[model samples]
Target: MTTAERSGAVQDPDARRLADLGYTSEFHRDMSLWANFSLGFTYLSPVVGVYTLFAVSLALAGPPMIWSLVIVGVGQLLVALVFGEIVSQYPIAGGLYPWARRLWGRRWAWLTGWVYAIALLVTIASVVYGAGPYVSSLLGLTVSTNTTIVCALVLIVLVTVINLGGTRVLAIAALIGFGTEILGALVVGGWLLLAEREHDLGVLFDSFGAAREGSYFAAFLAAGLIGIFQYYGFEACGDVAEEVPDASRRIPKAMRMTIYVGGAAATFVCLALVLAVPDFGAVISGENADPVGGVLSTAFGDTGAKIVLAVVLVSFLSCALSLQAAASRLMYSYARDRMLPGSGLLARFSRSRGVPPYTLLVAAVVPAVVVGVSRFSEDAIVKIVSFAVLGIYLAFQLVVLAALRARVKGWRPAGPFTLGRWGFAVNVAALVYGVAAIVNMVWPRTPDAPWYDDYLVLLSGVVVVGVGVVLMAVTRPYRHSDAAADDAVRSTAAPER
Candidate 1:
C-alpha cells in the first residue's frame, strides 16, 4: 500500500472521519488496540513512578503514605472518565489542546496546548534525569551530579533517534518496555513479598510516628505525590489519537485501562517495597535515604540487583520516549493549526516515516537544555520538575473545565463513546478532585524552607500562564487557526474573550 493508504486516507473510515473534522490524515493507523494501550501503559511506567517517589512518600508519612496511591487513583479515575468522554467526542491529535479548542475556543485551546506541551518537555527531562543514577550504577561507575546529567543527555539523544524512526518503531519500543517493566515489577515485587517481607500487611496503617509534630493529617496529604505522578501517563494514549484506529472508541478504553492497570501496578510495587523495608523509622529519620536501593540490594543481591536496575533503565528510557512522542504530536498539532511560531516547518512530516521530524527535534532539545541546567542547582531542578507536573495538571483541568462549560451551555458529546446522562456528575467530580489535588500539590508544607521553594509549583504555574497571556496579545496565533470550525462545537451563550 502507498503511504497515504496506510495513513488511512484511502478507503478507510478513520480517514473519512478525519476529513469530516477538516484535516488530512498524516499518521499511519497501524497501531492496534494493544499497541495503543501499550503506549499509555509504558508511559505510565509503574516501576519508574513508584521507584522515584517511594523515598519521599515513605519519609513524609511512613507506611500510611501508600494510601495516597489509592486516594489519587480514585480521583484520577474520575478525571479519566471525563477525558474519555472528551476524547471519544473529539479524538483529535494533541489531546488537551484540540479538546479545549473544540469544547471552548481557539484562544483557550492555544493556552492549554502551550502549558501541556511545555510540561511534556520538562517531564521528559525529569524522567531521564531520574534514570541517571540507575544508569551510573549499572555501569559500576561513581554516581555524581555531573555524571548523572551526562547519562541523562545520552538517554535523551538515544530516545530522540528512536522516535525519529517512525510510528511502528515507537509502538515496538513501547511494547518491549511495557513487557519488560511489568514482568520486572511482578518478579521483583513478588520476591520481596514472598521472601524478604520484614513487616506485616498492618504496617500499611501505621505512620510509625513520622508525622511532623504529631500532625498526621498534614503529612498524609503531602504524601499524595506518587499517585499524582502515576495517573497522568494515561492521557498519553489520547495524545497520539491520529495514529490509533477507532481512537474515539478505543482511546477512552485505553485511558481508563492506563489508570486501572497503572494504579494497581504502582500500588503493588509500593506495598512490596514498604513491607520489605527493614525499618520505617530509619527512612523517616533520614537515616535510610535510599530505602528502595537498600531493598533491591538485599532482595536480589549484587548481580541480580544490577539486572533489575537494567530493567528499570528500560522503563525510564521508554517513559522519556513516550513523553517526547506526546510533545512532538502536540507541537505538530499546534503547527498544523497555524497557532505556533514555525507552522510550516514544525508541521512537516517525513514522507517515508510519517513522523514530524522537526517537532521531534524541539522535543529533544528543550529537555536536553533543562537537563543541562540541572548541574547548576540540583535542588531547584527537582522543584522545577514538580512545577512541570502541576502545569500539566492545570492544563488537564482546563480541558475538564472547558468540557463542563460546554455541557452547561447545552453541548452534548456526539461520538462513538460517551457518558450519556452521567456526564455532568462525572465532569463535576473530576473537576473537584483535580482542584483538590492541585491544592495539595502546591500547599506550603515546609516551615524551614524558603518561600519560593514552598510555592514554586503555584508560582511557576502563574508565570507560565502569564507568559501565555502576553504571547496571545502579541502574536494572536489563534486568529490563524481554522480548527473547531463548526459553530455547533461552541455555545453561542458563552462569549469569546
Candidate 2:
C-alpha cells in the first residue's frame, strides 16, 4: 500500500472526516469536551450579560422583565437544536458561514460571513465597554467617557495577549472563567435568597407599573431584548469546531449545553436580583440606576460586593477572550477559502502555536477602533450593542432559514445528533421566533429621542447588510474557484458515518 494510504488508514476519525469533507485538518485538535463547553459558556457569560443589561431591563419593564429570560431561553433552545443538527453534519469552523455555504450557495455564504464577522468583532467592543463601569466601580474610579474608553482599550489588549498564548492556554483560561462565573452566581444568588430577600416570588410576575404606555405586553416585549442578546454566544462552540476532537459529535453537544447551562444560570441570577431589590419603584424610575450594584451592595456589604465584582470582572475578561478567539477563527476560515481580501496573510497559521496571529491581531485592533468611537458619541456603546444584536440575530436566522429550506428539499440528519420527527416542527418554530426577534430588536423603543438615535439599530443593520451586498456584487469574490467548490459540495453530499 502507498504511504499516504497507510497514513490515512491510521489517522484519527476527525482527520479522516475532514478529508471526506474535501479539506485536510489544519487545527491542533487538542480541546477536550469540557474545554469545548468552556469556550461556549464563557462566551455566553451570564454575569457579563446580567450586569450589562440589568438596569435597562429593569427600567423597561420593571420586575416582570425577568420573564423575558424564560421566553427568550426557550426560543433560543429551539434555534440551538437546529444549529446542532447542521453542525453535526458539517462539523466545520466559522459556524454559520460554512453551514450557510453548504446548505445554500456561495453568495449566501459570503453575505452570512460578512455580516457575522462584523457583528462578532463589534460584539467584542460592546462586551469590553460594558465591563468598563464594573471595573471602574471596583477600582473606586468614576466612570466617564474617557475612563470607559481607556478601560476598554486596556481590556482589548489583555484579551489579545491571552489569545496569543495558543489554544491550550485559551482553553484553560475559559474553563477557569466558567467556574468563576457559575460559582459567583450561585454564591451571590444564594446569599440574596437566604439573607436579603426583599420581595416575594410574585414580584417576578408584577411589572411595578414601569410600562409607560400602561401596556404590560409592550413592556414585556421591550424586556425581551435582553434575553435575545444574552443567549447567542453559544454559537462560539461551533466557531471552533475544527480544534475539538470528534467535532462532528462533540461540538453540537457543547453548543446545546452552553445554552442549557448559560440560560439556567442567567435565569437564576435575574430572579435573584429581582427578588432582592430593596426598592423596585426607585430602580425603575431611574432613582437607582445601578440596580445590580445596589443589590450586591445591600445583600453583601461593600467588601463582599467588591469580592463578587472581582468574579464578574473575570467573567468579562474571559468573555472578551473567547469573542476574539472565535472571530479570529472565522476570519481564518474565510481567508483560507479566499473569500476575504488579503486572505493569504490572515489565513497563515503559526507553525508552533497553531493560531492565526495576523487574524487575531486584526480582531483585536478592530474592536479597539470601535471602542474609540465612544469618545465622540456618548450613546456609542448602546448603539453598538444594538447593532451587534441586530447583526448577529440576522446572521443566525439566515442559517436557520437555510436549514429550513434544506429540510423541505430532503436534507436528512447525517450526524449523530438528530431532532428526528421533531426536527421539522422545531425548525418552523425557530424560524418564527427568529423573525419575531429581528422585528423586536429593530423597532425603535424611544420615539421621543432623535430619529437617528431611536432607530439606530434598524438603520445601522440595513447599512451594514447593504454594504455587504454591494461588496459581494462588485468583488465577485466567490468566482475564483468553481471547480474546488463543486468538489467540496460533492464530497460532503453524504458525510461518512
Q: What residue runs in model 1 are displaced by over 4 Å at the alpha carbon?
A: 1-10, 485-497
lDDT of 1 by residue, 1-497 (tens): 47876664657777777777777867877777777788898888899888988898889999988888898889889988888877887777888888888888898889999999878899998898889999999999898888899999999999999999888999999989888988998999899999999999899988898886867898888777877887788888998999998888999999888888888888999999999999999999999988989999999999999999999999999999899999999999899999999899999998689799999999999999988888887564457568778988999999889988888877777777778788889899999999998898888877687888777788888898999989999999989876764343543332221
- How far is 12's C-alpha from truth in model 1 (Å)? 1.0
What pairs collide in candidate 1?
none
Number of backbone-clashing residue pairs for each candidate, in the order shown: 0, 0
Per-residue alpha-carbon lDDT of candidate 2 for residues 1-497, written as tens digits (9 for 90 to 100): 37895586457788777766666656778788888999999998898888888888888888888888888889999999999988897888788888888887788888999999999999999999988887888999998888888888999999999898888888999999999999999999888888888899888777787876667787778777778878988888999888898888898899889999999999899889888888888988889988888888887789999999899999999999999999998888888888888988888988588789999999999999999877788667667788898889999999998888877766766778888888889999999999998999888878789998888888989999999999999998887534133122343344323
TM-score of 2: 0.96
| Per-model TM-score versus the true fold | 0.96, 0.96
